[model samples]
Target: MSLLRRLVELLYGSDRALRRMLQYWAATCVLYVVCIGLVLVQVSRGMTDGETAHRLIVFGSWGALAFYALIRASARLGLKPDQLAVSQAVFSMICTMCAYAISGPLRAAVLVMTVLIIAFCMFAARPRQTLLLSIGSLAGAGGVMYWLQAHDPLRYPPMTELLTFGYLAGALLATALLSGEMSKLRSRLKRQRRELSDALETIRVLATVDELTSLVNRRRMHEVLEAEERRQPDENGTCIALLDIDFFKQVNDQFGHAAGDAVLRSFSIAARASLRANDVLARWGGEEFLLLLPDAAPEDARHVLERMAERVHGMPVPGVQGRRISFSAGLATRRAGEPFADAIHRADNALYQAKEAGRDRIVLA
Candidate 1:
């Protein structure tokens, strides 16, 4: 079992693309092995000629070594399957042509292997490469047939070789056409996958982010609060705040909704900049936001909010002249056993109190 596993691992390496390339080469190698066996069968029948020696020694012996070398190079170099595909097509054709040149009576049957090579390259090579290989195969086979017929008219008759090359030519050109179609399909599928990925990313943003202010939406905020509640509250303290823009409706009524939107957008950006790295500020609804502070002491959280208030008080909105952005907030520390929703409710109550007392101030819950 261990020996079998090691051999399998040697042939098909650990990398996915490497494994696929090796598997393809293994299949091609098997074709050579099968051809070698047929050559042996011919030799057993008393055919001891240079043709037999060439097949067994050049193709059978040296071909095996080259095959192993190519496999090792592909693994070590981390070559992709597509790159190795072209190399394999070129290498296999050379050995096939060399063997075909001397096969004598086996020349007719050897054309089968030639056709197979063309078919394999049709799928593996790019469209232009497939066209080139197709033309090369037809030309190479025609040249070899003409040479053999002229040299050994008794063994390779002119009429028989012509008919055989004609058949192989038809097959090669037909496959080239089909290969062009397959390449088009491959390109289209890749484009669709990229478009689908982009669409999915857009959908994710819509689900979790507020398109208006680009903050976490109310739905995603609830998810964050629930996740935070499941974990233990920060040791220093976990605080949450509810904030509303002071007299926001008056701004909208005076300046129209466009200026109101610019104010909301500017406030969200400034508030986010003033918050801590671990803090989260989410859009709760229109004119209201939620802020969650983790790993912050009450005093530290208060100071953070106070700094935000000072920064926002005199900040100008883009189109709203003579008015600045200001928000009222209520802060509360989560008790050890309290649920997040309950803490947020206490914070909400304090926010109402802050509004009644005066807007643009922070009240503790």
Candidate 2:
């Protein structure tokens, strides 16, 4: 387990993209080890120059290790590793070209290394990026083949290099096309995730908001009350007001339900505009609104509702030609050691009194 933690620390990545790049670098380092082992075998068989192969192996191994450390160091300094993987691919290809320039009869081994580097980049880079890399690899290898054939065509045969070039071109082109399709799939999944998140937000709004008045619905108000009930007692006190529109049914009967709806919408806008930042007003039921004011004394709560009443009184009914609307409110402050429902019950009693003693007045409990 400790060794595993050490390996993860060596990667030094906290995000997916950078971690993937680090992992890819680690894989290429392993490939480097295998290639170095192959070079040692070619030395034993006397197939390649001993001094040139040894120098390539030593420097290539050091370069691979240094690349890993550089990526880790830069990530700690907040540099993103998105483009660094491409640089590694290009660097490894250049190293492979250097090896190919001196591999004699073992040049095919260096060509295979080029293939693996570009194939690894196919997974990391976009289609256009991978395509450009494929072309670069082809050019590098072609240049090496041309130089070898021009100077020493005895061991590096023209026919063999031509066949090798054709084979590599086919493999790199196929990898590029497949990478393009994979890039498209990744983009589609991201878009689908964004669309799903937006749909969830819309559903939440529909559940909590009233359609006609654009105020919080009864279910959501119940949630707010429950939350307040769980809170510690405040200094001034928490207050709730129950408001009912006066003669609402008479208005609906005299001028259709649509006009009544417009009156409710306009009244809701006016009432909401009069509230303080911390106050929450919800449509408790038809023609009824409940306002919750946290840390408010009864006097302060009454004053705010009275102001709301004046605003509602002056607001013109939207569909009705020349009519205006007014509301009556019952304000109650929560007492210590009392349940919130009991306080609201007292407010309901006060609201009944306000209705009986001619509507459009504020009653306190």
Candidate 3:
């Protein structure tokens, strides 16, 4: 039993407290059947009467029903191993009391079942629940045993004299060991799960973000835009703004491509800072960006872009060589019946108008 306990601890770690409790219940059931079978064989030898056999079968059937009902109830509740342990412990106490009533050598079975229950409660349930259930199970079992002895002295003397004291001591010792192991395993599993979740979130962020500008990349931007487009014609509104750096190539030619890259990155940071949390900013390509604005009208988008342009102009970019960095923006609002492509085309044309009208401004078509 000590070796088995050690092996269980090694295999399950701390998070497996609930699992171990369920295993204990299952093992108890199997052991009960074997013990009952041995009793039946010995008690029925050379007795041609079917009366004893029939009674034993009836008792076994009732026990089976009780076990099945508890298991089914636990499963329905989505009971974790820890919960199962508490439930099974309660059920085991009831079974032990019933055994006392039957005047059977079910004493061994009840003793084993009681010990397993205590182990589960101590190991699987939370500290408060463990203390509560353990005390409750112990008191309940003791009360039932006392009641049985009072009601029918002959039927329960063995339980009071032999089974009760031995089982209680065994239960307390087993519970102490199981509880310690279970707590350790639970702590370890929690740390492992937290680390795993953090790693997954980091991976997701890296996949969707632009490394240089720290904005959503082109692919992620498209995905977000498409999702917004699908949600249109609903109560919430949607708009897209296409922005291009005005005379960006001139800056690249005069200063260097590195300086031009710095300007693009700085402009992206400014644009992102100017937008609301719901707004999605992404690098569309060289010197171009797309913003998907949910719950925004063409007027609202125009206001947002105007604010973004103002912020960009205010920012200092070393690559701009003493000149202010500026952009042309096209704003398009989704019509109730219009396709996403049509809205995009309208925004593109509006952007052209902004460029055509001496640049550095927002144009709404």
lDDT to native, each model: 0.81, 0.83, 0.71
Off by over 4 Å in 3: 1-109, 126-179, 233-239, 247-265, 276-279, 293-300, 317-321, 333-336, 349-358
| Model 1 lowest lDDT segment of ten | 46-55
Question: In model 1, which runs have C-alpha deviations exceeding 4 angstroms?
Answer: 1-14, 45-83, 102-106, 122-124, 233-236
| Candidates, ranked, lDDT | 2, 1, 3
Candidate 1 whole-model C-alpha lDDT, 0 to 1: 0.81
- Could you estimate the TM-score for every candidate? 0.87, 0.83, 0.53
Task: Name the candidate, 1 or 2, with the larger lDDT value.
Answer: 2
Candidate that scores best on TM-score: 1
1 versus 2: better TM-score goes to: 1
Which tens-of-lDDT digit does each residue in 1-365 have in candidate 3? Answer: 59989887654334444445546656767856764665466457632234654565576557656654554455466766666656656656665555544435454445565555566466457755665665676676667667766776785584454466556755755575667678778889999999999999999988888877888988787778667766664443788788999889999999998889899888988898889879888888888888888888778878888899889999988756688889998888877767667877898999999899999988887
